[model samples]
Target: MGGIVPMRDAGRTGTLPATSDELSRLLTVVRRGRVLTVTGRFREPRSRLVREIARRLSSNFCDGAAVVAIGRPFGVRELTAALGCVPGMPFLPYGTADAVSWLAERDMLLVLDGAEHLAPEALAWLRRLLTAAPGLRILASGRSPLAFEGERVHRL
Candidate 1:
């Protein structure tokens, strides 16, 4: 709760607290779905909300997590390590297939920040990951939708 930083929208005439009860309710909705994408024109503020949600979920037995930025490909290995998984268990996965397999059966929260710039194809792994790991939940933020089937898109 404390880690969340409110956003200043200079684009508008007034600034608003980016993190609000509305965002909390949004998190509740996101929690209900296996996959969720938070979209907004204000990328920074939206991403801040996503990060806050992830922070709230971090202590809920999350095994892996990352705020994947634009221009960055898959970095699930670093997330896995952040979750306390041993580094280089066998090999680092650079692709989604291997990343999914690497995260098989793990109950984790993976955050994808700046998702709008991410190629839609890059998220093909989400469907499989959701199906394979029942305990996994993805929280993404971007201007556009991830377009994954069953993905709940919340726009701010």
Candidate 2:
């Protein structure tokens, strides 16, 4: 699938093209055997959206791949559980390097949510994860790019 595009509000006239097709194509490529990072502002009540994408990823990639969300106060445990993966502790305490290494080894999705505050750290983690885990893909939700090399960013 392509990157997740935010639905346009009714009657909105001007905005960036949603590039849903491109995002899907990229997703397909990544699903085959690559890493992807999705960065943008995610809307609240994200369960349904998360579940749908996770379901597709699970179906296509098997259970090895997981969507790991990093942020505060978002009920990530429940969300990951709903997606049928054991929810690990939030990527705090452990430094960015350690967190990335741990998650990469697991071959999980590694979703980084509400990461504006942790952008620098998250970028470092993403770079390491991309290098360390060939099977891992990241779907980050934030207000800006991680600015890593080869990062295919799709804005929301």
Prediction 1 global C-alpha lDDT: 0.60
Q: Cα lDDT for residue 116, model 2?
A: 48
User: Candidate 2, residue 7: CA error in Å?
Assistant: 21
**TM-score per candidate, chains pooled:** 0.69, 0.53
lDDT of 1 by residue, 105-151 (tens): 66666676766554445465566677787887878877888888778
RMSD of each: 6.9, 8.5
Each prediction's total of clashing residue pairs, residues at least 3 apart in sequence or on different chains, is 0, 7
lDDT (Cα, tens digit) per residue for candidate 2, span 1-156:
112222221123333233567546655745654434445555432322333344446545332334444444333233333233333334332344454455555555545444444534445545666788666665544566656675655555
Best by TM-score: 1
